[model samples]
Target: MTSSNFPKAERLLRRPEFLQFNEGASKLHTQYFLVLLKRNEGTGTRVGFTASKKVGNAVVRNSIKRRLREFYRQNKSLFISADINIVAKKGADVLDFHQISTELAAAFGRLRKKYA
Candidate 1:
């Protein structure tokens, strides 16, 4: 089953069948999270978050994933036209929800301007 709740738009995903954001995707270092973004192709942007055992036990990793997913869920609409992915780096395990959300919003704004 497909996991995306966000709708896809052709102009941003199908029109550009390449991931150009790798070279320029903004990186935000927060006290609790590290967010990475890249533009990709498909029906819509696919997002994956990775939190290794080094961050903590399984519980910690899962918590980080949930926060990351929620961050994307709340902000995905802002970039409804773009296929964007946000990955959580090692630092993300330590972050609180509000901090992660703020970082995500800022990153989205930066990407919006770049893609525009």
Candidate 2:
């Protein structure tokens, strides 16, 4: 799902960036994960992914992160101009791409209305 049009230049990188977003970010929840949206003055959109030990081991957590990144890359337009961090819960370890996309779409719709 890598896109030439969507470069990685705008993504959240440093640990501090994640912390800054996580501090008081507006949260949108779904059964699969929690979407934290932090509105900032930055242009375009940035994203991060996280899954705790409760979710799974290192491999499972990494899988969740990869899938979440692909999901975000595909449906990024639904998210407004802000920094985003998605925290996956235990259930995320078993969910397929379709289920993850479904839940995240709903959450994104709510966030769009909220941050609009």
Candidate 3:
């Protein structure tokens, strides 16, 4: 079974990495998010979450990010070996965990079909 732990190696943590990844990524747009996907030759997938000030105040932004991280952590197997950046839309802070999960699942399903 795939481990549930979200290790540091599985995250995009720096500005340069995000910028470089964005340069070559293909985008997937959902109702409450914008997912940027780029294939990587690395052995594991890496993900990053972004919630700009436009989304809400610090509290709301962090909540959105936490929800995104939880969804990714629980569904890591659904992703391929790629660098993915999930950016929250303005109203995403309004979603509950289940709603976020449902939307993200559909987005990832499309991603899998495309990259599979």
Task: Report how far off residue 91 is in candidate 1 (Å).
Answer: 3.9
lDDT of candidate 1 over 26-62, digit per residue (tens) = 5655455555555454345555566667778899889
TM-score of 3: 0.95
Compare candidates 2 and 3 on TM-score and give the better one: 3
How do all models score by TM-score?
0.62, 0.89, 0.95
Query: What residue runs in model 2 are displaced by over 4 Å at the alpha carbon?
Result: 1-6
Tell me the deviation in Å of residue 93 in model 1: 2.7
Candidate with top lDDT is: 3
Off by over 4 Å in 3: none
Clashing pairs in 3: none
Residue pairs with colliding backbones in model 1 are 32-95
* Top TM-score model: 3
The best-first sequence of candidates by lDDT reads 3, 2, 1
Error of 2 at 91 (Å): 1.5
Error of 1 at 24 (Å): 9.4
Q: Ranking by TM-score, best first?
A: 3, 2, 1
How many residue pairs clash in all the candidates, one count each? 1, 0, 0
Model 2 Cα lDDT, one tens digit per residue, 4-30: 234666677788988996478888778
